[model samples]
Structures are given as structure tokens and as C-alpha cells.
Target: MSKNSSTATGTSVSSRILLDAVTKHYPGQSKPAVDGITLEIPAGKIVMLVGPSGCGKTTTLKMINRLIEPTEGRITLGDEDVTNIDGDQLRRRMGYVIQAGGLFPHMTVAANIAIVPKMLGWSKEKIKNRVDELLELVSLEPAMYRDRYPRELSGGQQQRVGVARALAADPPVLLMDEPFGAVDPITRQRLQDELLRIQEEVQKTIVFVTHDFDEAVKLGDWIVVFSEGAHIVQYDTPERILNEPASSFVEDFIGAGAGLKQLTLNRVRDVELAEAVTGSPGEMAQDVLARVKEAGDGHAVILDENRRPLSWPSRRQLSRLETIPATPDAAIPLVTQGSTLSDALDTMLVSSAGAALVTDRRRSFVGVITVEVVMEAITRSRKASAMANDNDSPVGTNTGTIEVQGGTT
Candidate 1:
């Protein structure tokens, strides 16, 4: 395949997008909407432009595709100057997604996705293949959704269609402006997960614009905190920004739950898990009790023949039991290694058990995490952050593509 062409079903080759002192000024506005902003959006990673409303995040994004022209400075895609490129051709080569999908009311899902491919004069066979590929890419069943109109789908499903449509021609860069903002919180989270999954496969150079700092932290490989006039307050990986705020405004923008938010970046695998005593279903109550006693914890996690978690017998029942309960309730919440610390905490809260059973990707028993363990982990993290703040440079900050530079927004 040619360097410019993408595979039929996977990640496309991507190129870096750069802006040098890019500024946008509306004719009547006294001050520029976006002023003297210089940023390099790295290839094959999601770069988020986030700030409060009227901060010029959207204006900065529109300038990349020439939807809103830059008044000063220059924009470049790889080695080519965007100012010198034809607007129509430039846009077609880059995918654009907006809120609520912006789908045509009259168009079917397949037709919506096929719009770009059709415009590019692809053969009917190629367009059909591309439509099927994208529908599955976004977790929608191609056979069921292909012929359905946008109105027939749910809000979340429609948004998926919008993503599919944007990716129809396999553009190397994707520009998304609040694409998941219209859905409910639950749906929005699902959409975020879907986007992450899709990115793993497509590897598009994605520029996402949002007002929510949590969303930015969750989605961005590198985050650009924008203030008024598109001024960049901080440009760095989420970890450094959370641990070391460049200014008072950034710390305030990060808000009160900064430490807890940072926990989301650390997965369950980051912590050393405590081993829980386990027993087979047919094991005698005395044997199980002995194993639990040896571990110095009164709790025991029962496992089935397949090594899957079965239950955590209540303390009251365990006290008087002569034999292991055959029908023990499997009320213990289970979490995978890939789950975040925040995710484990949520499960513990929901189950009211103060603990979560961890499992491998294959669903086999691994270990458990208690409330005490989580608290200790948080304390350790805080101390580390405090130490890092007191000292000079932090680890993993100097050489990465996204550097934390000192500047005002």
C-alpha cells in the first residue's frame, strides 16, 4: 500500500499538525478570540484543547482546518503549509466530528458513512466494504444499523454513526468538537471507552475539544489547558499537570478532587495486591477456616472448579458453620487487572463490602484489595507528589513528545 493510503480495516498512517503563533481575530471584536497560540499536536495521539467557554478552544480547532481562518502565524500539517492548501481538499483529507453527529435527517446510517467515500469516487464495492468496516469499528452491528436512518437509533448509537461517518475515508487526522457531550452521563462514558478502543485500532491523530477537565484528562495523551484568547496555560501529560500545576489558575482549574482524579490514571495493576485465602467448593468448613486463619484475615474467597470467584460467606454464617455453605452468595464484586483504582473503589462502594476481588483477563482468581489498602496507596501517592513538588524535575517529563513548558495562557 502507498504511504498516503490506509488499510481497509486498521490504523492509518498519521502526521503531526503544528501551529506557530496562530491567532484568530473576529472583525468587530476588540481583542483577538485566539491570540499568539503556538502548539504542536503530536501524531497518533489524542491532543485535547480544553478550557472554559469563550476561551477560544473551538476557534483554535477551527483554524486547523481553515473553517475559521487564522489572522496571524501559520498552520502546518506534516511538512505542508495549511495556508497554501485548498480548503475543500484539506478538509476532505481530515475527518471532522461535531456535537450530536450532525447527520442528515434523510440519510441512512450507511449513506451517512458512505458520503465521503462516494465523494472520493470509490467504487460501490469499496464503499460498501468501508461502511461495514466502520460500523463494526464503533461497536455497532453492521447488518442491523446499515440500512437504518439516524432517527431510528439511540442518541449514543447516533453518535457512533457520526464517528463512523467521520472515519469513512480513513483520514489520518480526526477533529472532534464535543462529540460525546450531548449524551447522558452513562452513555457519555460508554462513548469515551469506545473512542479509546477505536483509537487503539485506528491510531488517528485526534484533536478533541472540550470544556470538561475530567474528560480532557481521561482522553488526552497530552492536554493543552486554554485560557481566554486561546492562551495556553499548561501543555503536558496528565500526570505532570496533576502533580505540578504551572500556575494558580491551573491548580484552580484542576479543582478540589485533583488527587482522586489522578488515581484514575493509575490502574489496579499499579498496586501490590493482597493474597486472599481461597477454597474449592467441596472443601470442608474446618479446612476453609484453617486456611483463612493462616492468612491472618477472617475472610475467604470461594472459587469454583474453573478458579472463578464464587462468594464471600458472611461472618455470622462462618462463625457457626459446621460445613461450607453449598449455596453461598457470590456477592463479592469482581474487577480485572486493567481496571483503574477509581473503578475498584466504585465497585467496593456499590457492593458495600470494602473490598474488591481482582481477576486476570481470563477471569481467573488473582487477589483482593481492601479499603485500608486503597487508603494506604492514596497516602503514599500524595507523599510522592509532595516530594516531587519540593524537588526539581519529575520522572517521565523531560524527553517525551509532550513536554510541560512554562508559559501563560
Candidate 2:
């Protein structure tokens, strides 16, 4: 997502990790929580560990921190043996967020966020600066929320503050355990979007735990699917898992309607459409006739030099109305290059707009997304999904992670 990084998957050499013959055992159980798991995690990648409850997915992740020490095997962080490092020091260098926004009962949001920096011996001024910065990073106003106590905030706010706290020190290695799981579904989605945004800004090495396959697919650079006792069933990109489904277990986990789900993930650019309708407000009503004749479908997008939309004036607007009203805000959402065809459909549904005014990021209209375009995008997405499933293609780099200036790590 960073401008400097061509690979949006967030990979870098410094954050790579490796697990060699990793195994963990509980005191009373004869079976291991983790059983001989060997995995390679490229740096700056988010590898999601997902499965049903008590599947040992969480246990396998915790072993990276010695939270649950491995009874056998080596854990390496960028070629350094993490097993030899002190647990506290190792944890301090790793950003961690839990589902509940684990704030101290007695601390203000600012203080809660400052805990890690304070532990790492940051000056008071530095910690204050970071607290304010993180609040903004998480889309919260620092002045109104920083001094507030955890009890005074909503669950969503609490979660944001917790994320601010975890990211305070800008550690390269991040561990998240169902970090958005505690909030309501709507709030959880917002949090997920925010996480994706922040992850783009900060290209950290992330190992995340989740029970939800959708969440894993949405966030993972690569997903590591596990069975009971931390046995790996499959490890690959989200697209690959969905399309290829290494085994019946993985396919069954995705369930039906996967084609629809995959549609949301692919972008419009993945497919193409016919030239769209175009027109001008003041153009000779007769000119509309010639243009409509040329387009064959009987329409043309009216454009200003800037290409901001004016209207999709019906032939009725010209024939029935005395004058066409040109209002900028009245038009549908200005669809951008980054938006998926699915996004265009969503905007159309919400606005009841017959077409999307497709634009460049600069807001200059490039083309339009008409009913034809929408249908084409959907058809293309479904076809791609089917092909991907047939070939087991990897679902990597489906998103754009925009870097925020001055983002740490």
C-alpha cells in the first residue's frame, strides 16, 4: 500500500518468521494443542489462523510469543530465535490487540494508550504526542476522547482506543486475537475497514487469529487453515482457498453462495464493458439524436471539461421538459478507478441512480457505469470466481492499502 512498496501484500524481509517442527502440549491432555506445525511467514504479511473453536489455532499463534510455550521446536523472528528472547521484551516489540479492548479499569484512554511507550521509557512529551497521533490514526478526535475513561466510552470507541494503544510503539510484528470480535456486526465491519486502512499505512508483520472465514479472507495476505490440534489443512491466499479449496473440509467451510462472496472481492477492472452513453445539457436536442444513433443504445454521458457528472437526462427530459436542470450534487456517486463493480452496484442501489459516473481519482469523468456495465461486472466476477475455483488461484492483493504520511512501521 505504501508508495514505495510495489507489492501491496505488505511483505518485507525484516518481519519474516518461521516455525520449525513446532509443538505444544497441555499439562493433562495426552494430545498436543499444536502438533508438529512447520510454517513460513513472509515479512509484513498477515497470515490468518482460522478454524472452529478449540481447534488449536489460537494456541499455535501464541507460541510465537511464548504465551503458550512450545514443548518442542524453534520459533524464529526474522532469523532470530524468539525462544531465546525474554517474553516481556519480545511482547513489547510486538503489537497486540484483543477483542475486548483490554483497557485498564482505572486509566484514561490517553493513559491506556501510553502504557507501552511508558514501559519502553519514552519521555512524557513523546508519549503525549503519540497518544494524540494514534487517536487521529484511529479516526477519533483526541481532544474529546483522550482524557475520557474507558467506562465513559462506547464499545466501538473502546476498541479504537485499544487499537491506538497497541499501535502506540509501532512494532513491526503484530498479533491480533479476534480484535474486532466483541463489537456488534456493523461496528465490527467499520473496525475491519479501519484495520485494513491502518495496515496499509503501517506495513507490519501480522499474525492474526479468527474464527470467521470472511474476516480472514478480507484481511489475510495468506490464510493458514487449521484442524483440531493445530494441524494445518491448507495455507494459501484467500482466492486460492475459496476457489481451489485444498480439500473437502475447506470447501465445505466456505459453504454455498461463495460465487457471490467472491464477486465482492474482485474489482471492475478485472473485466471490461462497452463504451457508455454520453450527452450534454445544452447540446442541440438534435445533436442528442445523432449521438444516440451512434451509441446504438440511445444515450450519452453529459460531461463538463472536468468530467464531473451533470445528469443522465432522459430523452424524456429533453422532449418532455422545457429545460434540463444541471445540478452537481444531484448526480449519483462519482465512481473511482479503485472501486469494484460491486461497489458501483451498492452505490446505485442506495441512490437509486440509473448509472455511476465513473471518474479518475482526480474526479475527471472517464466513463460511466450503466446497467449494462453493472451486469457485465457481475457476470465477469462470477466467471472469474468459477475459473479461480477450478484452478485454485491465490486471492492476494485484492485491495489497495493507501499509506498515510508519517505512518510508523
Candidate 3:
């Protein structure tokens, strides 16, 4: 597995995928696991495949890399027909991730990430650099994690490393099958954010499989709704899928909270945040209290030297202390500007102040997002979507041409 001409420039050239009447029929089954389905996945975008349990979504994903050879039809990557290629060689050119990281316990973090690069016969220096670069890309510090074993890391850390490993060779396409399902809710959200940030930088063609519709909505630029036999019920953007359901099955899949799911489409940056009275550590508590009262704010946010939020305390708590403590309560619900309003609402619900603290990319506090702000955003979104619907305007962008045969939509 040497460096191919495609990667000689040290950048991934994301390639479009084409499935032409692809079908998979097992030996004993009466019906094919995946019926003849044709879909075109655009380059440099995240496409989610979602369906109910026992659907052939996972089988469809495996077919792309030849992990599960299609019994009929052709598969194409960019201009090349990969349907008949060697499975091992084809897989080396694509990144695949599964649940719980699928990491080898005996290997260290650096060793795990270097597996693909090493197989590609990269120089030792080049492999080291690539490992560190991917680690940073996934928000893990290479210096601190490179030497640690898989058992030494938290569940979230392991998942990050797994992603780093998948990206080790800088493949043009990535395949993920419920990659974040094993983690806790908070960690899963963080991972989703990290994936979005990384996708912005790398721009890989991603095909992800998930049973969770909310996760699909949050991450997918395009989504393919599948039925029992890998049938394409609908293929479109998240906005269109929510606003214009092709059929009753699609509507039921969306559920009753379609309006609430709209929050997942908008980011916190779209709405304005409320300003909070601010103070620095070592500042006179009385001065902060006076400012809080002057502004008629219930609480004041204490900042560190770098303008990062330290703690948020009320007027009564500020009065009891002579100066703000360098370290206050450690649990501050923080969200970045790119976070969705739904994420902010989750944060606010857990916070004692009923508001989530907004931060910049560097974790510096910017402002606060309250429940009122989210509600207003939701109202505005509904009104706008209704207008779009009434006018018969298209909802989402069509990145590539789609062809469906014997499917619902």
C-alpha cells in the first residue's frame, strides 16, 4: 500500500460515489438484503443513511469499500469502477470506523494511529508527523496521549483516537457506523461537534450509518432515508426532509417533534446572546456586586486573566466574599458559537442559572444564551419555513444528481 498518485500532493481529493442498481442477496434469504438502489453521494459532504433496525443500511455502507461484496450491480468511486477490485486494497484507500473505537488494546495511541501509514510504507518521520497532526485534528494533544495505551484513556478519548486512526492516511472518503453510539450523551455531543469542525477543514466524502435521526440531522449535509430492504424512501437535505416528507412512512420516522428538531438545523451564532455583568479574579467583590445591582442583573460572571469564564455567582454569594475566588464551581455549562440551539437548551436545563455560557473557539466567554432566546429562534424558524413552503421554494441544496429505481422517492 504505497502512496498513490491521488495522495501525492498531501491532500485528500474527495471523490463522488455512485451506486448503480446495487443489490446484495444472501445464499438462503428469499429477498436481497439490499434491493436495487442507486444513489449519488457528492464529494466533500456528509451523507447519512438512516433506517429502522435490521434495515440494510450497514450492508450498503460495507459494499462501498467492498467489505460486503454486492451480489449484483456496480459501484463506482469517482470515475473508477470499484465493484470488482480487491477488497483489502480497496479498503486501504478508505477510512472505516465502528462502534466503541474498535481499537486494539495492546497498542498505544501513537501505534494505533500509525497502522495505516506504516502499512503504506511511509517513512518513520512522516508517520510520526501524520499521527501528531491527526491527534490535534481530533482535539487530543499528541504530546500527552501519544504514549498512552487504549485502556488508559477515557471512552471519549478512545473514540477521538479511533477517528484519528481512520484519518491517518488522509483518505478521500470516510465510513462511520454508529461511531458515537457507545459514549455518554455529553461526550457524544462533543464528538459530533469535533467531527463537524474536522469536516470543515478536511472536506472528506463521508458516508455514515446511524439509527438515530437526530444525530443524522445534526451532522448530515444530505440524508438518505432507508426502508427495510435498503430502499431509498427519500434523499434530500435535513431541512427538506423535515418540512416536506415524501410519504407517511417518512413522516412517522420524523415523529411528532419535527418542529423541535428544527432547532438542530440552526446554530447558536444565528441568535443574539444576552450580556452578563463581568468581573475579574482578585477584584473587589463589593465592586462586582454594585455593578450587578446597577445593571439589574441577578448574577455576575467572573473571568480569569485571559477572559475565560471562571464562575458565575449571584449578588448574595458575591457579598459574602472579599474577592472572587480563582477557582469557583467547576461545572459551567459552556457551548461554542457553532453549537445548535438544541444543544444550548440542553446545557441551560442542566445549569443552575437556566442559561448556557457561550464561548469562542479559544474557550473565551462571549455571552449567555437563555431559554427565551432559543424559543424566539424556534418561532422565527417556523414562520420562515412556512413561508418557504407556501411559496413552493426548494428547501435544501442539491449537491449531486440522484437516480432512484423501484424506491419510494
Candidate 4:
């Protein structure tokens, strides 16, 4: 995958959160805006808060950042007591993103992005570099957008700037509230991909909130489903949530197409990989052994001189001088380099031949894609969806009846 390709997975951070009976109440309300809810967000990962509008999902999210002070319980980040930390100090170290980019109409994009850095009193050179870095990080060109005012940009651009601004100070934690909510669907998806790429490179602890169930499934490392008064109906991985819901409430909320929703979290392939080793398709085997001495398993992946997959050699073929076509299973076909990780995984699983050839849409082999890469891609895709919504279909669950609450919706 290209560094910027949709499926990049390299992370060292462990994004974790611990909330002990966190609750928020309005003065006149009979029930808490956020009821007694306890949850954990794993470190260096994206945890999504998803539910209906009045479900207190947003309220649950805000309490973590102290945007809305919890009326009860504690919020902890890593091992620190976030509830007691200085709110301003806590915020500076955390990334905050809201809908429509929240860019200041009066400020240039660079200046809007520079707000956090300037507050942190970073040196002029430091802030300038940070601003530039953030623009590129969010896929916005620095030279193109730095001097432009928010009014001059489109909604998506503004949101990108907002994200750039939130990430400007390089906070270890991120709080996102529908960061892509204000844009058109296509633009939202593009932004979602861009954010995924960014998360892969930056590995921050992220808490993302979305109203869409599909978005929750697509982007979450773990999803926390809420209902009236911020009740946590379920807190689990997207796969688990799809396969096993917390209750009928959770099922009803996700609605009629949960199986199709599964595809959003899955691709044609995941769960496997092909080792990064190859051999010449038509070369002499005893000679090829001299080239790749440690392929280990008494077999070598045969490739054309141009690096396209040909076949996997049998032990006999490994020593034979005469040409014998190896099992087609020897060489697996790869789909697009950045096709959904689930698709690649599905291809590998369905092919059932150890590994599959990873190719672009043109059917040219890029390299071998194994289950490992597919899993990594799944991780990245889920992380990307951590901040977005699973608003579309999943990988392949779209066949027959989709039982809601284990029954028909």
C-alpha cells in the first residue's frame, strides 16, 4: 500500500480510556444527560460513541474532554486523573474536532490552525512548521491553503483545516464530533479516507462520535452504543457488535441492514498474507535456491521477471529442469492494492491457497498479500471509521435474511 493509500497500518500508540460511572445531569432534568456509564477506550485506537440523537451519545463523549463536566464518577486518560486535571491543560494535550471544521471566519486557514500552537507558545518557526505539517497531514497543501481565509474554502476544506488545527499541536488524544458531518457524502468518504491515513501515521487516542450506525461499524476499534440518558447498551468491536448485539435496543438502533453493514467493516480479504518472497517463474530450481536460500518451506513463489505472480513451485518442481506447471494454488491473485482490507482477506480465505496475489484493478500483481496485511488493513479501516459512520454496506454479509436481535428487522 502507498503510504497514503487507504489501507495503511503502522501504530505504536495504545489509545486507552477508563470511565468509572461517568454521569452528567441537567439541573431541571429528571434524568441525567449521561447516566451511570462506565467504559474504556483502548490506547492508540479509535473508539466510537454511536446512537440516536436523544441517546446521550454526544453527552457521553463531551464528559471525557470535560466539555460537559460530569456530575458523577471519574474520567481517566491513560493512568492520569483527567477529571481533576486542569481543563485547559488537558485540552491542549487532546485533539478536539467539531463539525463544519469550526474554522474562524476572520482568520486565515493557517492562522486558524495556528491557534493551539500559539496558545502553547511554540516558537514562531515551530508554529509555522507545525502548521505546514498539519496541512499535509490532513491532505491539504500548505502553500495553497496557508494564507487563505476560511471563507474562501469549501465546507470539506474548512473541516480539513479544523482537523489540521486540532492536530497542529500534536496532542496524544483526540475528541471528534461528527468531523465530517457537514460535507456531502462523497466528500465525507474522501475525508474519512484521509483521516484514516492520518491515524495510521499518528496513532493517537481517539474518541469519535457519530449518529450513523454504519459509520460506527466502519471506523471503530470498539463501538460504545448508547440510548436514552447515555445508557451504554453495548461496547464491543464492530465484528462482535454485528455478530452479537447487546440487546434488541442496540439492534433496532442499527436498523434493518446490519449484515450489509458488516461489509463496511470487512473487505473481500483479511485474516491472511503472503510472505514477501518470490522466485523466477521459468528459472532452474537448484539455481533459484542459490538465489533465495531461506524461503524455508521447500517451496518458492514463482514470478515473471517483471515481478508478476506465476505459480508456487512444488518440491519436485523446485529441483526439476523440465518445466512443470505448479498448482494454480501456488500463485494467488491479488485485487486492488488499496481495495478494502476485508476484500483482500476474503479473496485469500475463498482462494484457500495460503496466499493470494495482490493486484491493482488492471490485474497486475503488486506483491503477495497475506492474512497479516489483511488484518492490518482491517485495523486501519476500523480506525478510520472510528471517527466516521458506517453509513454504507460491509464486505459480504449481504446475502439472505439479516436477523435483527437475531430475528428479522
Best by TM-score: 3
Q: Provide the global lDDT of candidate 2 against the true structure.
A: 0.72
Q: By summed lDDT, which 10 consecutive residues of candidate 3 come out lowest?
A: 1-10
lDDT by residue (tens digit), candidate 3, 1-409: 1110000111222488877778899999998898877777888889999999888999999999999999988888887899667788789899999998999999999999999999999999999999999988887888999999999999999999999999999898999999999998888888888888889899999999999999999999888888887887777778878887767888888888888999999998889999999999899999999999999999898888878988988889998999888995668888888788988888888775689888876668899999999999889888987787788554333223442334553
lDDT of 4: 0.68
Question: Residues 52-117, candidate 2, lDDT per residue (tens digit)?
Answer: 799887887788878888998888887689989999999888888888898997999999999889
Pick by lDDT: 2 or 4, better one:
2
1 or 4, greater by lDDT: 1
User: Which scores better on TM-score, 2 or 3?
Assistant: 3
Per-residue lDDT over 1-409 for candidate 4, one digit per residue giving the tens place of the 0 to 100 score: 1110011122432335677777788999997787666665667888788887887877777888888899978877767888779998888888889999888899998889888889988899998888888888876788998999988998888988888888888888889998888798646755675676677788888889998777777677777777677665566677767765656787787798564465576543343434555665455567666545566554566766555666755566566645434335533444544445544455567667555566543334555666665555556655655544554644312222111121111
lDDT of each: 0.79, 0.72, 0.84, 0.68
Estimate the TM-score for candidate 2: 0.71
TM-score of each prediction: 0.75, 0.71, 0.89, 0.65
Which runs in model 2 stand beyond 4 Å of their true positions?
1-11, 267-376, 386-409
Q: Report the CA-based lDDT of candidate 1 relative to the real structure.
A: 0.79
- In what order do the candidates fall by TM-score, top score first? 3, 1, 2, 4
lDDT head-to-head 1 vs 3, winner: 3
lDDT of 3 at 60: 94
